[model samples]
Target chain A: MILHGYFRSSAAWRVRIALGLKGLTARQVSRHLRKGEQAAPDHLALNPQGLVPTLEVAGQGALTQSLAVLEWLDETQPGPRLLPADAWGRARVRALAQIIACDIHPIQNLRVLQYLKREMGQEQPAIDAWARHWIATGLAAFEARLAEPAAGRFCHGDVPGMADLCLVPQLGNARRFGCDLSPYPRILAVEAACRALPAFMAAAPEAQPDAE
Target chain B: MILHGYFRSSAAWRVRIALGLKGLTARQVSRHLRKGEQAAPDHLALNPQGLVPTLEVAGQGALTQSLAVLEWLDETQPGPRLLPADAWGRARVRALAQIIACDIHPIQNLRVLQYLKREMGQEQPAIDAWARHWIATGLAAFEARLAEPAAGRFCHGDVPGMADLCLVPQLGNARRFGCDLSPYPRILAVEAACRALPAFMAAAPEAQPDAE
Candidate 1:
């Protein structure tokens, strides 16, 4: 498999964590998102959305969307399960993941930030504030969910699963945007547990081959 | 089961369509988004994010996030599968869905629009243009994906699955924002296929009791 990704993309980071957790190796091809390489014709053929990380499988075609790729890995690959075996537990884990993937990340991603500056004539500080605002909002909700009985060493129960994969990357974005993380102690605790794992360690943005 | 949702919320409409497709029924409770009822304490207790389409199951508590709720219903409910049995197909369908769910919808949802107006002090025309820009961008990608060999009558195969559920409602948003649909013939064809079904018809925003 060849994973088309960027070093600092939270979505790509989620896929990297999933690959490590599944004990699967994929050749990396960096699409420098800041340079708009993802929008190039060849990359667009693989992923119409022009987004990182598109997982190009050997027999199967390219798989776009980080969550979908994560699910595909957990389903087909032999490794630690990224989701729970139970139905409701799977739902809870997925919902937690979506809080980051759907609600938080997309609204404040690089493209949107670019739009704010170039299209809307917003200054850098306001754009940063915009990023911080959405991240803070989503994380507060995520923190509240972590306080639920279902949450344990990870986002769901004692095992780190799909939600943890999403949360750790999102927290990286939050910290980068200078969003205060003190309000999310439960999230911090989960992050601490996840960071202790070799899989999580190997998948950090700074550890990536393309990291600056 | 009880669904706490607003009439015109595209996310809620996705859940409604899923329920209809699965031949299941959930009692509807309107949380008027325009009135800020979603952020009320009662709704927030059910969904920490205070978002609509909170599916309150009998014993399993509330399920948040439209995609998660749809997955849960597909996993547990006795109906036509919302996802394909094969891992690759599932991933493709899911990736298509996430093109809207993650990349498109959240970027231009009601709250985000409110923030553009109230917080960022953007004029309505600019906000409308912003919404149209994203809708057009995402739909173009979606259209490109549909042109692939894998796409049949619906997003993945001959059946309307998760991606179709996401697509139809997102089209509603696109039209509302005056996005040019002519650019996406494939998307429009799929939407037509989905709309022809009684399930999709019943789940339309205007078909709901809470629709103004």
Candidate 2:
């Protein structure tokens, strides 16, 4: 499999952690999102949405969307389970993941920020605040969810799972955007625990070959 | 199951279609989003994110996030499968669904628009343009995905599956935002096909009790 991703992309980071957890290796293909290489025609051909972390499977072809790709990897690959075995538990994990992937990240992505500046004539401070607002709000909710009995050392249990994959990357992005993390001690602890794992550690943006 | 949702929420609409397609019934509980009822203490207690259609099942507790609820419904409820049986096919349907659910809708959701206007001082026209931009771009990619060999009458085959459930609601939103839909003939065709189904028709926002 070939994983087309950006080192700093939260979505791509989720996929890399999933692959590493599953003990699977994919050839890394970088699309410089800063240079708009993801929107290039060739990349768009592989991924219609022109997003990163598109997994080109050996036989199944290219799978876009990090959640979809991660779910596929979890189901098909034989390794530690990325989701819980029960239906309700799975739903809890997925909801937690989507809280970050769907609710927070999309609104704060590069394209949206660019649009706010170029098209809407927004200044940098407003954009930064925009990023912080969504991140802080979403993380507050995430922290609340962690208070549930289902949450343990990780977002699901004592081990890292899909929700942890999402939470860790989102925290990385939040810190990058200078969001206040003091309000989310649970999230911070979860991030620290995830970073201690080799799978999550190896998939960190700074550890990637594409990192500047 | 009881679904806490607003008539106009695309996320809620996705779950409604899922329930309709599965031939399952749920007590519909309306949360007036524009009036900020979803942020009420009771609603927030049930759904920490305060988003809807939260599925409160008999034994499973409240499940938030439309994608998570939909997946849980597919797994626990017996009916026409929302996802394809094959792994690759399921990935395709999920990717198509996430294209709209994660990428398009989140960026244009009511809360985000409110933030843009009240917080960032963006005017109504600019906010509408922002909605249209994400909708048009996402729909264009959705159209491209439908051109794949796997696509048939709907996003994935002739049947209205999970992707179709997501597609119909997004189209409703796009039309509401005054986006130009002329460029997406394939999407329009799929929307027509989906709307032709009783399940999809019954799930339309206009058919809901809370639609104002």
DockQ of 2: 0.93
Where does candidate 2 stray beyond 4 Å?
none
* CAPRI-style class, candidate 1: high
- Tell me the tens digit of each residue's lDDT in model 2 across B27-103: 99999999999999999999998888798988658999999999999999999999999999999999999999899
lDDT of 1 at A96: 95
Q: Which ten contiguous residues of candidate 1 chain A have the minimum total lDDT? A: A16-25
lDDT of each: 0.94, 0.93
lDDT of 2 by residue, A1-212 (tens): 99999999999999999999999999999999999999899889999888897999886689999999989988899999999999999999999999999999999999999999999999999999999999988999999999999999899989899999999999999999999899888998998999999999999999999999
Worst lDDT run of 10 residues, candidate 2 chain A, spans A52-61
Instruction: Report clash pairs, candidate 2.
Output: none
Give the per-residue lDDT of model 1 (tens digit) for B92-190: 999988999999999999999999899889999999999999999999899998988889999998999999999999999998998889988899899
Model 1 steric clash pairs: none
Backbone clash count for every predicted candidate, in the order shown: 0, 0
DockQ of each: 0.94, 0.93
